[model samples]
Target: MRKLGLGLAAAALCAAVPVMAQETAPAFDAEAATQAYMATLSGAARAKSDAYFEGGYWLILWGAVVSIVTNLIFLRLGWSARLSAWAGRRTQRPFLRSLLWAAPYILIISLMTLPWSWYQEYYREHQYGLSNQSFGAWFSEGTMGLAISIVVMSLLIGGLLALVRRYRENWWGIGAAATLVFVAILLMVAPVSIAPLFNKYSPMEAGPLREQILSMARANTVPADNVYVVDQSRQTTRISANVSGLGPTIRISLNDNLLNQGTPAEVRAVMGHELGHYVLNHSFSLLLGFGVIILLAYLSVAKLVPVLLRKWGGRWGVTEVTDPAAVPAAFIVLAVYFMLATPFTNSLTRMHEQEADVFGLAAARAPDGFAKVAMKLSTYRKIEPSTWEEIIFFDHPSGHTRVSTAMKWKAENIGAADIE
Candidate 1:
């Protein structure tokens, strides 16, 4: 999610306190409004939309250019090696040889970025009124997170190096594509495995609301297996739910906070949106689109890395992918590549989100429910924006736009959408 207003909105997925009543504000019917808005696009808007849809050609160019520049700079500075050495030296005075062998380049990068997780969870989140976590809360979470990151990054780095060495000039591009596929697999399965490491989950106890939720699932053909509620309240207090997995593995999971904080209507609305994702097969489509992007990235990386590495590797006091210092340079390269591809990558994701919004309305059969769900998110989102702002920044429909959609649907279905 692009956090339509700010990155702060993402944390809204995790509630920090128990549910409380909110002062009634407004309705948000995203489905119909967005469809109407899409219909209203003209000239440049249509072209830009087409460009985004057809594949953001410019993003590919930017990804290659950024990746090249980042690698050149990182390798030149030998930053990764120094940072790894610095951490090892401070923590245990470990011998440079041992640290170099044991920690590896990727491990060092992960270590250095530890502060980011801290800052985001503790400081930035608090400032935004989204995180109520205490110091101890943040610390324990950070330690666990570090452990996970080290393991994941090490494997990614190791796999990438293996490719570079065996495949030579072709490795960079192939590796980039491989990374995209790897990430998609993680997205599908990780919530089941990785999320548990951070929180607890249990089946929703038997009850009317719970039954209604299940009934809705049954009514809509959503799989009943794996419907679970996670103890998300252990960390923060925000409402969330999701429809995850593919095929028989599919499941509907909700944050306990949603159960506690949200009204039944809100819960249904949220689930309806998630169900929309399920019916529309958002993940499958996204994965496919991402694969296409990966191919584009790989082609660019293959042509660019060797030429740049041969020219600049020695200057960075590193010549190989395994070099600790070179790892940071490579990370920087990858970051730039991913970042430059943002508009393009994000466009695909937004399209899927839009599709789900429409599907949610039809499946949930409750524009009002969807409307309220949007209201809950208003604090975390940019409620309204100029047309250009939406095209550029919104990966999800804007709150106002979402509400309008719901209203439009109500108008067509019932002849009047009285709620604002």
Candidate 2:
């Protein structure tokens, strides 16, 4: 009887083990834990947090509306179709017709948006206590941005023209792939060169926080030469850091606000999250995924455009597609396509951010830190979103999701030691 009882007890123990392990896993609840901590703090912390989000949410909404409305108005005006028709019909050189049609929309629409875009950026930022940059600074930045946009858009339109002229129906995928590569190249280079134009960067000053951050990087096998801190305080009060560049070009960078104001744990937490982005190849994944989307979407447009042109071109007074006036129509169509596709893109992006959140918690050993950061970012990022809101608009994990994960992690690893 005793021997039989022992055997049964061993079997029971074995059966319970797996369930126990699952229950005790060190998952993150950084979000909840931090909010709980925030709940404990006084008035100033809460106010600062609230102030952080002032312009971000509304601005994004307004910007999207403006983008769509502006494009729609242009399209409805038959501007592009008219311009393109005039150019295509008048130009003796067929080769130059599309370029001529595209040129006007490129110049005018950009000019149209410049004043409002600049004001929205400058005023909204100042209103939120997020920026200290002077008008000259803002203007200079805007000018550079406009220059880059023109270059990139020209390249993009030129490539699209190539596909439309030759492959026609099959061009969308190729064009999308081209866009991905172009963007990737831009990302890989911009951080090292273009970003420096606006702000000064220097090695992180000697400090315990710097030492600890470096230690974490080493432990993670991140080959960073030295950490850089930028004078982002010249522009904004918000704090951030990034691990930008690839291979030899890789730079581990943080803003002056991060160094000056953020707590050591907070800095570490955010850096860990950015490092998570690098370690996980989030950029690459996004680049490729976005490429696929562009390819597929453009293909759908390709399919739809020809039919629509055949159906409505005669009525709209446009003959061939290479019309300047049709540029507005095409852009509007593309905008609609992208707007409808937002849910899928947002979902994919959220997943990537969540993955980075996990990696950050592990790497920083500071789940609580990320949770607190969420409270801060809530000023700009949504703290919580309904499922539908998350699906349609957010391209990153909502603060609630981030904090909850952090809290869950804390709950599981309650005994884990805080960073030194």
Best by lDDT: 2
Clashes of each: 19, 26
Q: Model 2: per-residue lDDT, tens digit, 54-147?
A: 4454555566566666765565567766766677677876446666666566776777777667768787677666788899988888878777
Q: Give stretches of model 1 more than 4 Å off.
A: 1-104, 246-248, 320-325, 415-420
Candidate 1 lDDT tens digits, 32-133: 455544454446544543444333344445445544554455455766446555654555422333334335443444454446546545775565556667
Per-model root-mean-square deviation over C-alphas: 13.9, 6.6
Please list the C-alpha lDDT of all candidates, in the order they appear. 0.62, 0.71
**TM-scores of all predicted structures:** 0.72, 0.80
lDDT of 2: 0.71
Candidate 2 accuracy as TM-score: 0.80
